[model samples]
Target: MIRPLLLLAAASLLLGCAQQTLRGTGDLGVVVERATGSVQIIETSHQTRLARIDGLGDLSHASVVFSRDQRYAYVFGRDGGLTKVDLLKQRIDRRVIQGGNSIGGAISQDGALIAVGNYEPGGVKVFDSKTLELVADIPATPLADGSRNSRVVGVIDAPGRRFIYSLFDTDETWLLDFSQGNTPKITRFKNVGKQPYDALLTPDGRYYVAGLFGEDGMAKIDLWHTRRGVERILDGYGRGEQKLPVYKMPHLEGWTVAGNQTFVPAVGQHRVLVMDSQTWKQTDAIDVAGQPIFVMARPDARQIWVNFAHPDNHQVQVIDSETHEIIATLEPGPAVLHMEFTARGDQLWLSVRDGNEVQVWDPYQLKLLKRLPAESPSGIFFSSRAHETGL
Candidate 1:
């Protein structure tokens, strides 16, 4: 009887081990299927798709943020859906309609809270990261006319458990500190610029810059020195030249700082603007294939890759970081909406919306390695973003 019991216990242990699959979350990520309202679980190490989870709701303008542990993904959908997906389980763990229209979201530094920026009601809502419970609702500062709350854009996580964003209608930048508790201490910077469309936080969380759509320059605030207020940089970038009609608003979040220089997309112009990071002054502009949309840096900061808007979206141009020259140009496909680099920068991924595929390439060689079929893919976010600030 003792021998039989020992054998049964051993058999049970074997079954338990067989039921669970051991893997790390570091290599895991999701590709947004914009048209289907779904995401495909993918593994970067293998460059393969693991599974697809659906019912995310209106991903036409979707973005994702990862938990500190990188086990879950918080997807912000255009139709106001905030979904918490368990990467290990390959399913949605919890979901809530947090707003009427949310463009993007960010997770706190400690991974304790999730913040969603809204457009309809024009406010930011904070939620408990674990339970998806509303922790705080801070409306956007109302305009001077007091008719409506200004639309919030460029919601991003910063150091010290804080959130930084821009007010479109009010021309202001707000810094919300949540380090104390649910009640946040707010610091507002007024007169940032006209029509502040989008903002980006430097990798070190030192500077928060907003792109001005209604003017020629950008509004920058040195987080390390907030008393100086908003300082305009790259002023008169298009002053002496006729500006072309903007096909799409250039996204500042894709701006890159390689070494002492910063590269950004010139709104309504077929050029990539290079800035001196230390002085916050325009150094040079490199002509590109089209009106640049995303001017992103490779992980190692050796090369800057750029894509365009609308009719020129089929091509991608690579620029050398040091010389500020167009190194190479490749025709990826139609409607290249987004690009993401692997954690180590060895591989680069491009989402071709019209092509209905994601292309993985060897950045150094500029050669296509593989193509994965996707349905109107827009954003390809990896779990590596879990550790980075203001992703």
Candidate 2:
């Protein structure tokens, strides 16, 4: 029938499309789960199928982060282990098996090192990117619970060689100094906020801001002086007679920094909060759909795209960055969780979680160009700026 013919034609075109795997450029990797254990890697440029890293056993595919050099992608497999994937080889470089649940991690700028977080034990492990060797396991003690119930959630490196920051499931933040080399002088402290979910350090390392969930707010940690780490809280909501509950269940999910400003997606609040990084002051908040989970911005800093977790109709809403206006809405069918754009900001690639496929969209024309199916593609990472060079 025409349906089979149409699929055949689409397949032929995708097979013929060649993706230039340019190393070390602005590219995105969506670390997604197929079923319970498998992880698929999809190239955003030309919608080419690059590789698949598998063999995990009933493990949860939590998060995926690319090295600063864009050479190796570190995949934190919930129950499996930490997987190091070679970008060039399009294969698994090595898999280091660790006991606790694989929460997630972030890579250093040099790409020579990586930190993997274990949710159960509330510990993080630094590893060798090249040899897949385990370097040091900086065990974190949960603040309130003396119990291992606290989880290491978001992990990002500070500017320069100053500190390593990771937000715990609870309200604690761990700051590790790597300039001292192998043994990083660790300074662990509590973020002056409730339910610290994720944190981002400004490009200049002037501020370390964390998104709060238990309370409707965010915490800004002044890291200008490593010795004197200061923090300020920003209220994100107002309590009405109906009690909208301004700071109640404020789940700050995805965030991005542009110049001296910071944009955060308050998932539970269903709004985006803009703040001044230097002064740690609230600027304005743009409203979006309810349950806005995954938020991202284009490389050009022109638009901010947010993805909702609604099962009935999952979509990506494009908001003008400068104007703070809603511009476009893109639907990738059912169960769409995460999204990423090519370097040039021309094509937008999304993970259709329920469909078990990756949806490719043309941002300029606001069109759905193609859908590349990869079983349980929870994570999709690309190789450099191949797409930008093509256009």
Tens-digit lDDT string for candidate 2 (1-391): 9999999999877766734334433443544564856666555545666556666544444666666566666677777487777766767778877747866676665566677777767677888778868777877665565655577755766654433545556567777767768687787776557767667665455667776666666666666665666465567453331323333222232466655666776645567777775566778788876556666777677778777655423667888888888998666677666677676778878878778778788776778899787666554555452211100
Query: How many collisions per candidate?
Result: 0, 13
Model 1's lDDT to the true fold? 0.92
For model 2, the superposed segments whose C-alpha errors exceed 4 Å read 1-31, 57-61, 142-145, 166-170, 236-238, 241-253, 311-313, 383-391
Per-residue error (Å), model 1, residue 286: 0.4
Candidate 1 has which clashing residue pairs, if any? none
lDDT of 1 by residue, 358-384 (tens): 999999999999999999999999999
Best by TM-score: 1
